[model samples]
Target: MPPKQNPDAPAAPDASDALDAPPTTKTPPEVIEFWQETKQTPEELAFYAPEYLCLTILAVILFFPLGLVAAYFSYKTMQDNKQSSWEAAYVNSGRTGWLNVFAILIGLGIIYYALLFS
Candidate 1:
């Protein structure tokens, strides 16, 4: 049975009207990202190139061969620095220091052997 409607009242909304309307479109959620960036100044980038020429030369006086090798490394370190090759300079510097130490040690060893044998 149909319900009775009052003549003075506004027409009721149709259920089909809601369904017939276009649906709201689904959109992907917005993506947000964060990152940290580092900046360096020229002064901050400045690095020292090590050279032990005097030490290597003295080592040469102690043990000629090792000292010469050490001096060569020292020269390479300086050359690398002049060429703006920091890593190579650093390696050469370390080599020179170690060679100098070995040279001095060998010199002392020679003296010790001479004294012990004499």
Candidate 2:
């Protein structure tokens, strides 16, 4: 399907359309001279942002060591709280090490069987 065009626009001009363009008016000589003579304001310089840098560095330094200490303490607490003895922990169906040992043996047996069969 063909697209529609705007009817309000005037008919297209030729290649020399720039020649028919409007003329630009110049500023007054006094205003131009004043602008030329005036010096622009200097931008503010920042020589030291040491506080911001110091804070960022301090946070990075503290976070890692603090997290490590917290993790170490948690692990030590878990290990030291010995209600989790091996026999009691692995006790299920009234068998302590039997099930665990059998499970390990079965896993090893499967690997052995695979090696033998394969």
Candidate 3:
């Protein structure tokens, strides 16, 4: 007796069938651009984002309170840069850098006192 086969099921294509069939052309996926597609203005080109994130992180590690303050200013500086407020960014960047430096210095001073005075 012959084996039972499903008549509704599609048959596998042979090499001859492939040669007879038209080639399928798949459309490429659309490439989307991030932000804007247009060119930036002169001022936008001159964007100076001086957000010292590494220093802020280091400062945070050195001294919690003061480093938190420095991190705040660094965040403000980044916000200012995004808002295109160069003057405000400049002020905030300076404040952030100084605060980080001061925080590091304070940590070093504490260490010095602990080691030498002990």
Candidate 4:
């Protein structure tokens, strides 16, 4: 008689097959946004119209005299060799100094009065 095959035997599971592989990491959206923002150009400065140019010129005119007096005081102090604290004086002098102060309060009292009152 031929040997009978067993019908109740259990099948072995495959060990080489993968069923639970790890997923790849994805990049978050926030980090990708800066590259687009950095490509943008800044807006240009405005400089049209004659009035704007004139106001800029007048501002430079007003600033020049203050700078000149400060420079003159610095020059005089260097010649004297007496501590030469003109840099300190220049810092303390605010916008206008003794030049304008004396010119207004004592010397040309009428000039600033004309500017302010008249």
lDDT of each: 0.76, 0.38, 0.78, 0.37
TM-score of each: 0.59, 0.22, 0.63, 0.19
Off by over 4 Å in 4: 1-62, 82-118
Per-residue lDDT of model 3, residues 1-118, tens digit only? 9988999989877866554344344423231121233223344647766888998998999888999999999999988876678899999999999999999899888889999999
Highest TM-score scorer: 3
Q: Per-residue alpha-carbon lDDT of model 2 for 4-73, expressed as tens digits?
A: 8789988787745533333234757765554344321111112111122232233334344433333333
- The parts of candidate 2 lying over 4 Å away from their true place are 1-94
State how far residue 77 of model 2 sits from its true place (Å): 17
Ranking the candidates on lDDT from highest down gives: 3, 1, 2, 4
Model 1 bad stretches (over 4 Å): 1-46
What C-alpha RMSD separates each model from the true structure?
A: 24.0, 30.4, 17.3, 25.3
lDDT of 2 at 9: 80
Q: How much lDDT does candidate 2 score?
A: 0.38
Model 1 TM-score relative to the real fold: 0.59
Q: Compose the digit string of candidate 4's lDDT tens values, residues 1-118.
A: 9997788977655543212222223535553453243322121111111122232233334445544554454445333322334454334333234443432343244456678897
- Sort by TM-score, best first: what order? 3, 1, 2, 4
Off by over 4 Å in 3: 1-45
